[model samples]
Target: MRLVTFNILHGRSLRDGQVDTGRLAEAIRRLDPDILALQEVDRAQERSHHADLTDVAAAAMGAVDQRFVPALAGTPGAAWVPAADPDDPGTAGYGVSLLSRHPATAWRVLRLPRIPFRVPRTGPHRWPQRLAPEEPRVAVAGRFATPEGPLTAVSTHLSFVPGWGQLQLLALRRALAAVDGPVVLLGDLNLRGRQPERLTGYRPLGRRPTMPAGRPDHQIDHILLRGELGPVRLVDNPEMELSDHRPLVVELGARRG
Candidate 1:
């Protein structure tokens, strides 16, 4: 199966400020991944013309099964608060998403606790605002029905704060421990592959730089595996203006070593 991870930046094109829905659609259409993990997807946000990115992406990729995990809730281009239950899994806004060609067996959203806000040493950056007391961040997970068996897939956008991401990683590791069977974790960890074992038990398929506009010094987006699934391959989306970060795609088969 082909899999991909992308930070669409709400479908905005950095080139000429144009929204290349067709380009986005064509890319997804060509890739036609079996499973896709997407970040920064917008749903009804005024900026992207109130477009439901989840729907558009699925349609573009021709995915049969699709669902999204909201990182926060008020609207796109805004900070959000997770459900009080942190583990509620029903909230939606700016979180991660999983789109698959297979059916879904089960799904849930596990909210990762954030680091206490510090009075910015410098100042808040303009885009992708920081979390306030009200809005919390989270990771979305789904157990899907694959021909091989039940497969657990998780998608998340981790915290960008200094040491805070470590805490979020701990929470994610705990949440994933509950699943039984082959598992795949995909998303923008905001961390590099320097210490994969420390963040997640699985190994990263590739270590190519995946951040910053033009100059990427770290491999932020990753695809990891647990147990045996089959052969896996990492695919890099050719340099595009869709977002600051490039998309990473992975493919899986029915057999495993």
Candidate 2:
């Protein structure tokens, strides 16, 4: 099976500062992933041409099943609110998504709580600067019926705040305790290096730096597995035009059905 995790930055190419769906689709096609997890996705938003970016990605990858869980009702870097529900049918929203070529048998959602206060922080050489309030984040899971048996795949984008990302990861781990079968977690954790592995005990299938796509120096995107699966046949971080991070792709054996 070939699985990929990518943070598309809302399909905006940093090169020209444009949201070109054509380029996004082409990149998805080239990866040709059997299962794809995407973060920082836009839907019915003016920034991304009012197109359902998750749907676009699903079609691009030829995924037979998909789930987009809206984390915020508004836009990021502007104005937005925590979505009332996971399946927020709002005209405009942003969140994470999971797509699979295999049939899905079940689905689950987990909302990661964030810091409640908004305070300004100062750097070593700069005065205190108040940043935008932290936004709500979510994780979407899908249990698929593959030849290997039922496997649970989760897609999520975690908090960037210090220590908070680890808290959320722990919460997610507690929530998955009730689920059965092997598990595959994929997304941008914002927790670099081996932090996630140290916290969750899940084996990272790949270890290539993926941030600042132009010149990646550290890894924030990852593909982690909690249970047994086939050996890692190939692992790659495919360079693409959209997003600030590269797409981390992993392939295990053939017949990725």
Candidate 3:
């Protein structure tokens, strides 16, 4: 089974600053991931032409099942509110999503704890700036009935602030512990290095840098596995200009009985 994690930057191309669902769909079709985890997904947002990005991606990839959990009620970098109505399609929001070709039997969304205190931003020269409010975060978990067995997959986008991201990671780990099958976690964690592995006890499946698609220097996006899912390897793709971050793809072999 193939798994892919990508931060689509709300389906906007960094090269042209355009949000074209057609282009985004074609990009996902080319990747052809069996399971896809996405961050920075927009739904009914004016910026992205009120497009349900997750739905578009799912249709494009021909996913059998999918789920989208909003972390916020409005667009990022703009005036936004908290997400309250899960059934309201007209409500604009930003969040993470999961798409799978395999049938999903169960699903859950875990809302992570946000920092109570405001975090101050730093200037380009590393000077302290005005305080900024912490955005709400969430994790979407899905239990898929794969040929190898049930696989629990999670998609999340954590805070970029130091210490706070770790707290979110810890919460995610605890929530995932409830699942009884092999777990595959995917997202643009924002935290660097081997911190995720150290925090969640999940081994990183891919090491290729994904951010700044033009010339990435950090492997912020990741696909991590908690239990053995056989010999997993990265799927190589030559072109990656759809979003700011390059998509990370991995193939999971049948589990050994």
| Local accuracy of candidate 1 as per-residue lDDT tens digits, 1-257 | 77677777777777767666677777677667788888887665666666677888889877788877676675643555553544243334565678988898787878788655532332346554444443356777888888878989888877766566677877888888878998888888777765555667786665567776467766788887877787655456545567788777766655753
Best by lDDT: 2
- The regions of model 3 sitting more than 4 angstroms off are 85-87, 120-130, 235-239
Task: State the lDDT of candidate 3 residue by residue for 1-257, as single tens digits.
Answer: 88899998899887788899999899899889999999999999888999999999999999999998888887775687667645466778899999999999998988888888878777768887778777888889999999888999999999988888899999999988877979999998888889999999999887877767888777888889998787875555334557788888888787677
Model 2 residue 101 distance off true place after TM-score fit, in angstroms: 0.1
lDDT scores for all predictions? Answer: 0.72, 0.89, 0.86
Using TM-score as the measure, the top candidate is 2
What's the TM-score of every candidate structure? 0.85, 0.93, 0.93
lDDT of 1 at 23: 71
Q: Where is model 1 more than 4 Å wrong at Cα?
A: 76-92, 118-135, 213-215
TM-score, cand. 2 vs. native: 0.93
